[model samples]
Target: MNQHKKGLVVWIGIVLLLLAGALLAGPGDRVETVQETMRDAVLHNVNRISLLGLKEVNPGLISAFLVTIILLIAAALIRIFAVPRFRYIPGKLQLLLEQAVGLFDNMARGASPHRFRFVGAYIFAAGAFIFVGTLFELLGIQVVTVGGHPITLPAPLSDVNAAIALGTLSYLVILSGGVAANGVKGVGKTLKEFSLPISMSFRLFGALLSGLLVTELVYYYVNLSFVLPVVVGVLFTLLHAVIQTYVLTMLTSMYYGEVSEPSPPKPKKKKQASSPAEHA
Candidate 1:
């Protein structure tokens, strides 16, 4: 009991000291107003990058490329170094990998039992991309913009374009599955749900953007910038990562299953019996 009381008192003292220090410190050269900060969070400044002679690119695009490269490299390394050493009694790394793969496999099977192989692969890839891409922001890797300003690379999904592209790509995959299973009839079925891409795009964009905006808001104020931003940013990012990944993958698999279901055969018509008078 005494130790607990001592620990609490020590923590309170440290917090008081930090609060005093923050109160004494001046807001150093903050020219941007709260509105400006919020605006910049939504519509990033003219910090564009030129790629392959293309001018005025969003930083989120760069972040997407970075995340893609990272995932590709990691996959290559794992394939080269990890797969050959699998044992009947699994080790930690192997167990972890198996569990992750099994999760999507089971989900796909449950949702699209008729054609789950492709759906499982597609959803697994999509979920990994989303979950990893959202967490990428936590790295705090900074890149220099065309305007010579250093800005942290935001999550790819936070950008509207990236979200739309992912959503459209998932829709295309679902459409292809339908076409493969049911042909023209499947295409007609898939086309009926035209708003899917839009809803998916905005869902990802809004969820990720909310986290980014909240983090930016927290860091904008000097008083609250001490330890609160870290906790808030991490919690928001982690929550968004898990929730968005699961939501997108689940929706994709469900829709894919629905569209790709085979059509039931038409019942054979029964022959009419001849009347007794005609037979006589």
Candidate 2:
């Protein structure tokens, strides 16, 4: 009706036309499926660890261990170097560290208002791991396998076993909070969930793996590779990193609150009133 409305209508028609053209475009020579994307990687058995008569360990286990070590060393460096230099007037690094810590601390306090003391550090540690480990893969760091093939190390949570380990550890932290606040009753109550570890594990694994698979698909197809995979892959990784970090921390704190909260006492029934005639 108006000039502005006409412009909007023109834009919508242009977008729809582009979509139709793209859909009608003939199939490319290369085809990709989820299974093919997943199976093409040399992920699991690449660099097997053989130690002391043991059969062999998975490469993902090694990645998890390496990530843990890196986290520990970084923490130690910050404590030794950064803590000594902290001043009243905070700079960029100091401000960032304090803010990051404060965010999780606030989440912990908000979720478990009464029992944050027990789970604050646990939540912080888990959040840091998920956030940092996801980003670590973007470095494109490669490790050579025993079989002489080089493969980029994936985020530990990308591996099912490592995801299971991470989930189990978080569940244990929650269980410990319950036990601390409610005694033996806490452990039983936490265990009642029974499937928390498995659910957490698969949720994390699925999210990370889907991102990995999509990125792989983009790279696998030559037509889609130019400049697009970097954008798509980075976006997916960053989204999963932030999302999974928040999800796990939120769930851990919420469950800890449920398990640690003191059970409310039942109200007693009111006494029946006696009539004057009955009393006489």
Best by TM-score: 1
- The regions of model 2 sitting more than 4 angstroms off are 1-37, 40-55, 267-280
Error of 2 at 120 (Å): 1.0
Runs in model 1 deviating more than 4 A are 1-17, 270-280
Question: How many clashing residue pairs are found in candidate 1?
Answer: 0
lDDT of each: 0.88, 0.79
- Candidate 1 on 1-280: residue-level lDDT in tens? 9999999999999989998887788576775678886776666655566555676788788889889999989888878888798889999988988998999999999998889999899999899899999999999898877767777888988888889999999999899989999999889989998999999999999998989888878777778878896688787789889999999999999999999999998999999998999989
Model 2 C-alpha lDDT per residue in residues 94-142, reported as the tens digit of each score: 9998998898899989998879976888888889888888887786667
Instruction: In candidate 1, list every pair of residues with a backbone clash.
Output: none
> How much does each candidate deviate from the true structure in C-alpha RMSD?
3.0, 8.8
